[model samples]
Target: MSGVDFEQVMQAALAADAGVAGIVSRRIFPLSAPKGAPLPFITYQRVSGAPEAVLDGDAPCERISIQIDAWAKTYGEAKRLAKAVRGVMAGAEFAAELDEDRDLSDEEARVCRVSMDFIVWA
Candidate 1:
């Protein structure tokens, strides 16, 4: 419990979500998606994290700042996928919130991406 697998926990949370799975299927990946894998996929990157301190010791689950990107062939799809991600985070039992969001253009990959920053305790 001390060395929590935040990435695995997050990926499971997203993959098990019906709404998220409908659009991306099982294409959720860590750090980055595979090169030329497919469209309408998801990628996540860890920005930073810190263990919560208590009087006796640190909490098992740490506070993590993560960036999640929804990539698609179209801007609309990316936005929609991003919306689903936001919804899941909002409805989750754990502590999670959207800190920021942005629309990115991947000229090299010819894809539209909706990037989101979230702070989560996991």
Candidate 2:
């Protein structure tokens, strides 16, 4: 997928899950970069031999994985945000995984690797 598409999905996920206003604060890497970077890279692919109703996937029953780095003002706050995000995402029929990492600086910012599979229902 394109970088713009990735950003939109990330922002939507953050807003739907955490109720937070999200912007593409950083454009550190490409949307489809495979390696030569840190973990939690956002990736997308079309599924083959799938039905026609699927959005990103080739088949209607298929889905694509989305990954993003999430940050918050504090670790506790980040965790809370991640939990809220997951809760809301579940209702949207998206499976999400939130991985949190502590920020070394005093800025109280932490990164969360959020992933979900996008599926278009009938």
Candidate 3:
């Protein structure tokens, strides 16, 4: 898939996750060029209703970590964008991490990192 395609997939997947009311905010970081560097990170915090499993004690508060290195063209750019995006999510109720080692296919190279955070209940 192309970088744009990868980004769309990631966004769609996150938006469709269970218990997500809506995206409170979103940020994109443009990274420097270089492969294998950390990509921009995206975090989404829940807006309402606790995870059913968490309430039932069947599972802890749902913490999801999704890494999308497919949209970056270089390692430096990915890392830079990841950090920049994470900065955007600072003080958010949710947390996320960007994996630096992963690289998307050539077609999936882009220049920005996307991060979001959602709070289930706050």
Candidate 4:
């Protein structure tokens, strides 16, 4: 955690996976996607995790809470993209683990979205 680049680690893990790379082409956005962008993309945000304390001046254990979203034109595609994301996250060594998964689709926008929450400890 002291010398770790959390975001780079996550991005590298995702890019290294063939399944995820093929689907999204490493189009993982931070915060939001571009206007009039293409479908089948990913967006993620980092939220602050709960504070931690340690006795005897030990390095405190901290966690990074990240929310990942997959957006596509169809439900199946969105789900596939999410599955790829989950796979990458699961196989990574950030001390990251899955927390929750949610579906957030908008029919009017013709966009299918799947949200996944994961925790990485430092």
lDDT against the true structure, each candidate: 0.89, 0.39, 0.36, 0.83
Weakest lDDT window of 10 consecutive positions for candidate 4: 50-59
Per-residue lDDT tens digits for candidate 2, residues 6-107, read 335544555543244332222223345434543322333322223356467565233334333333344455455445544544465334333332322243
Q: TM-score of every model?
A: 0.89, 0.39, 0.31, 0.88
lDDT winner between candidates 1 and 2: 1
Cα RMSDs of all predictions?
1.8, 8.7, 12.3, 1.8
Question: Candidate 1 at 1: error in angstroms?
Answer: 6.5
User: How do all the candidates rank in terms of lDDT, highest first?
Assistant: 1, 4, 2, 3
Give the alpha carbon lDDT tens digit for every residue of 14-92 in model 1. 8999999999999999988778788899999999999899999987768989999999999999999999999887777
- Candidate 1: residue 2 lDDT (0-100): 38
Tell me the spans in candidate 4 whose CA falls farther than 4 Å from its real position. 1-4, 58-61
lDDT of 3: 0.36
Tens digit of lDDT per residue, candidate 4, span 50-114?
A: 54666756446667799989999999999999998998887777657889998888878989999
| Higher-lDDT candidate of 1 and 3 | 1
Alpha carbon deviation, residue 93, candidate 2 (Å): 4.8
Per-residue lDDT tens digits of candidate 3, residues 88-108? 333233433333233333444
CA displacement after TM-score superposition, residue 52 of candidate 3 (Å)? 8.4
Best by lDDT: 1
